[model samples]
Target: MPRLEPGQPAPAWNLPTADGGRLSLSDLAGRKVVVYVYPAAMTPGCTTQACDFRDNEAVFAQHGYAVVGVSPDPVEKLATFVEKESLTFPLVSDEGKEMLTAYGAYGEKQNYGRTVVGVIRSTFVLDEEGKVEVAKYNVRAKGHVASLAKQLGISL
Candidate 1:
């Protein structure tokens, strides 16, 4: 599947969140949303990326953007990850990778100089109208949030 592009409507999603609540794209209508997809929960890279978003969550909120994370982990594991990392944002369980595939966030990618098939660390910024404002794939875990913030014109 091709990656989503700017001006394209974001794929609809209704997934279980870490907080034991369901979150769907419609629930976040009228607001900009940051949806990031990671490979797994509790892994080093995933943890760093998640923490980066968590730490800068206020900045995202101040800019009217809601942050959400998706990974092929169960809701129970996601809840544990959130608790362990002190994450404040919602982390959706995508065990089936349905949402990930729809967003083109899961596919083949080069890892460690070798071709691999798995979740491609990616992020998408959706406008109030649910159109994709930005779509980034193969993003690095560290400093990703800062780069995204800069792209969105967020000072912090």
Candidate 2:
């Protein structure tokens, strides 16, 4: 599937969250949202990326943006990862990969010099109207949130 383009309406998703609650795109309809998709929970890269978001959540909030992480992990694992990392944002469970595929965050990608089919590290920023404002695929887990902050003109 092709990645979503800026101005396209973000796909609707209602997934289980780490807090044992549910979140959906519609629930955040009037706010900017950052939807980051990763391969797994509790892994090194995912941990670093999640923590980056957690650490800089205040900056995001100041800019009127809410952050959410999506992975194929179950809610139980996501809860554990959130608890262990002290993540402030919700970590969504996408065990079916339906939402990931809808956003074009799951598919073939180069991994360690070899092409593989799996979750493609991706991020999307949605405007207040729920239209995509930024769409990035095959993003590095490290320093990604910082880069995103820069893109959004948020001072470090």
Candidate 3:
């Protein structure tokens, strides 16, 4: 997988959101966007990460950033996750993993000391122009929002 780097243009995407609406990267054109990829929804780690993002939604907004979550799950599953977690941000469905692969979020990685191909638990912070300002891979789910906030210099 090709790793994304700072200053690289984020891959364009128009995906189905949990709210039954489509959201394109273009829709967030004028704002900083944080696109995070997870392996599955409603799982323990994913849930923790998602809710962390949810809890920090205001902090992200205060710093002029919009948070988005992406997963390989289908739309129905994404919707369920949002409803269950009361997530305020969009949970996008990437059933085909096309967008995931493009973002280098889906690829081979170490799992339990074994190599496996799956979602890599990644995050990308895009500038207003959609250029990547920060890129991270294989991040731990726990405390990721706080870490991201620190990385972006936002006060909790």
TM-score of candidate 3 on Cα atoms, chains taken together:
0.98
lDDT of 3: 0.95
Report the C-alpha lDDT of model 3 over 1-156, residue by residue, as the tens digit. Answer: 798999999999999999999999999999999999999999999999999999999989998999999999999999999999999999899999999999999989999999999999999999999999999999999988899999899989
Ranking by lDDT: 3, 1, 2
Per-residue lDDT of candidate 1, residues 21-121 (tens digit):
99999999999999999999999999999999998999899999999999999999999999999999999998898999999998889988998989999
Tens-place lDDT per residue, model 2, 86-136, is 899988999999999999999888989999989999999999999999999
Model 3 lDDT-worst window of ten: 143-152
Better of 1 and 3 by TM-score: 3
lDDT of candidate 1 at residue 2, scale 0 to 100: 85
Q: Pick the candidate with the highest lDDT.
A: 3
Report, for every candidate in turn, its global Cα lDDT versus the true structure.
Answer: 0.94, 0.93, 0.95
Stronger candidate by lDDT (2 vs 3)? 3
Model 3: CA > 4 A from native: none
- Quick one: best TM-score, which candidate? 3
